[model samples]
Target: MQTYPVDIDPEQLIRWLEAKHAASPSVFRITAVRATDERMVPPRGTHLDDLDREDLREIATIATLEIAPAHASEGWLLTVVVEDEVGPRLPDKGALIEDEQTIDLVTFDQEFIRTGRGNASVVAAVEGPEAEKRMARLLHSIEADRHNSGPAKSTD
Candidate 1:
């Protein structure tokens, strides 16, 4: 139940996630790719590496978490797209794509207000051992990144 501040480094977040899949033979069961700010605009094919930290901080973000289970050689490829938005809404989850094979979808909007002095809320639908391990790694990476980035500056 650790808490992550609302103002996280978007670029670092994406890099950490990408690193999970870049390991030898890829240790991650799920791979997450993120596009923040104006980089999410246009044809939507902008490379994550092409965007800098400042650009990431100034625009909206869309992160796609792609999962691959460990059983079948080609397991179902489910994609979870997380989009940033403003305003009010209770956190929840719903099906974006459901079928016999793939179950691609988006979770409820995990809001992070700039003025709010609190942690961002996340809702994960996936479960089981692999999923748990993946989540733990992601969380650990985030915490480490935050700490290494130094203290948070006053946005007021």
Candidate 2:
């Protein structure tokens, strides 16, 4: 198996997450923005100065905006999942299908959304929407796989 590492800003991730949540406000919720890096994403640019709570909220909002009704209705969240590592509830078990080994963003339902670790991306990318769709498919696949996997194994 081949794998690669992806780097993303926490605040940006939060924004993206919240954006998706905005679509289906009734289903999803913005619980927390957990990350080891307290700084999150450094705000910059021709007009920007520094990262602030607004930046974080925007990041979360953008992420949430990317959420499609098909996925959001099922409680999908944008997250980063590394292989074989136990983390937060991300919805997917690291099953991602993409042309690139390392992608800036990926969607995990509940099995991979973790915090106090580097996973979500806070920086904006040119192909943000494309990335969102790709991740959405991955999340949909996770749900499908779970349905196919059938009953859980019992410890006896």
Give one digit per residue, the lDDT tens place, for model 1 in 1-156. 222232344344444444443442243365555443332233245454533322332234455555454433322333344565432222234513222232222221122222232233333333454544554544565658643343222121
Whole-structure CA lDDT of model 1: 0.39
Instruction: Estimate every model's Cα lDDT from 0 to 1.
Output: 0.39, 0.33
Q: Model 1 off-target regions past 4 Å?
A: 1-10, 29-63, 67-123, 128-134, 145-156
Winning model by lDDT: 1
Model 2, range 39-152, lDDT digits (tens) per residue? 234344424444343343112111111222333333224333222323222233453323222212233323234333323432222234444455445344344443233222
Best by TM-score: 1
Q: Per-candidate TM vs. native? A: 0.29, 0.22
By TM-score, how accurate is candidate 1? 0.29
Cα error, candidate 2, residue 119 (Å): 10
Superposed on all Cα atoms, the candidates' RMSDs to the truth, in angstroms, are 17.5, 17.9
